[model samples]
Target: MDHNISKHISGNFNQELENVRNHVLAMGGLVEQQLNSALDAVNDSNAELAKKVEHGDYKVNAMEVSIDEECTRIIAKRQPAASDLRLVVAIAKTIADLERIGDEARRIAKVALESTAKDQQGLLGNIDNMGRHVSQMLHDVLDAFARMDAEAAFRVHKEDAKVDREYEALTRQIMTYMMEDPRSIPKVMDLVWSVRSLERIGDRCQNIAEYVIYFVKGKDIRHTSQDDIERDIIGK
Candidate 1:
């Protein structure tokens, strides 16, 4: 193709990219809702709310598959190079992160459904707080992606430590309770799973933030710590 024709095709190719991004955003919205619903279900011991989350997982999975295929098709057809390739690669990775986040949310809902709680107050409250933070982290990471704002992405990365700390505290507390009273063992087991799912969700949020940094600067932030990312490069 001539330069003019190639340019035209590239412009059209952007539409495909935009479509995938939009679909991913839509999936993100649903995942966000699923997290909230899962938290509520756990707090209230509502099997119905958990069921809603279970059903929503199917849609999230389907969206991820559709977006991945579209990105693949666009690249195969356009043969994008340089920054164009970067953007496409970023989209593909972002979709995977979103899908995993959806899976984490599903896991949380499943725990809620299976749990039999003697004390809903502590187990549900701690994990719910963690879930809210993770959800907000994801929201900001997505915003950074849409805006191409590396600084905002860096800020979201710092938030992961808070979630991790909460997860640790919850784990210790739940384990102590189980040890103190063996009868609480059954319920505490489910709480452990609940806390674990929330922690994984936070981890995935961090992954998304790393991707945002990658998308913005073409930098690999995965192996590096938050302090390293901020002080070594993103800060400067």
Candidate 2:
């Protein structure tokens, strides 16, 4: 390739990378909005809000497609090597995670529709808190990814345990309620599913945090002891 043409190709690849980043952020933003709407639907028991979430999922799906196509073009044309290759793969996987997270939010909205219990009836113990915490975790993970901040990502990872504890506490309460009044089982069960969906969202946030660390540091950082990751993350 001629020198000027080589420079032009390099510019084009960088622009493509930027496009990939923008698309991922767009997907993340949609998922974030979905989470908020899901929680609102649960609190208000509004079927319309739930329906909106289900339909808005298409935007997240399309963002993933656009990002995938651009990433594929760059991979085949530029053949990003070494660190660049790793970044491409990380971006792809992160987009997948975000899309899955959106699916879980839609599921929560579905459960909201099935529920007959009012948000203020105390039928779903501590779930309001759970929704807030899990949503904040998602926000933090995406912020970490946008800034490439490994430290912030690790903080989000550590917060997952807190969300789990909250979920478990809520579960025990629901079990106690079910035992005290057998007739309440059907109505209370929907709360169980909604809270469970929030817990799953927390788990996905942890996965997103791990991916952020991977992309920022080019490290796997998966299924390892926390101490080991902290030790290596600092060194890197």
Best by TM-score: 1
User: After superposing candidate 2, which stretches have Cα over 4 Å from the reference?
Assistant: 1-12, 118-120
lDDT string, candidate 1, 35-111, tens digits: 88887887777899899999999998898888889888988888887656776787788888888888877778877
Tens-digit lDDT track for model 2 on 1-236? 22322332345466667667777877898999999998888777789999999999988888888888888988998998755676688788888888888898898888668747453267543787889999999999988877767788999998989998998999998899889988888878878888888888888889888876776666888887778888888353
lDDT of 1 at 149: 71
Lowest summed-lDDT stretch of 10 residues in model 1? 1-10
The CA-based lDDT of model 2 is what?
0.81
Candidate 1, residue 62: the lDDT equals 91
lDDT of 1: 0.78
Colliding pairs, model 1: none
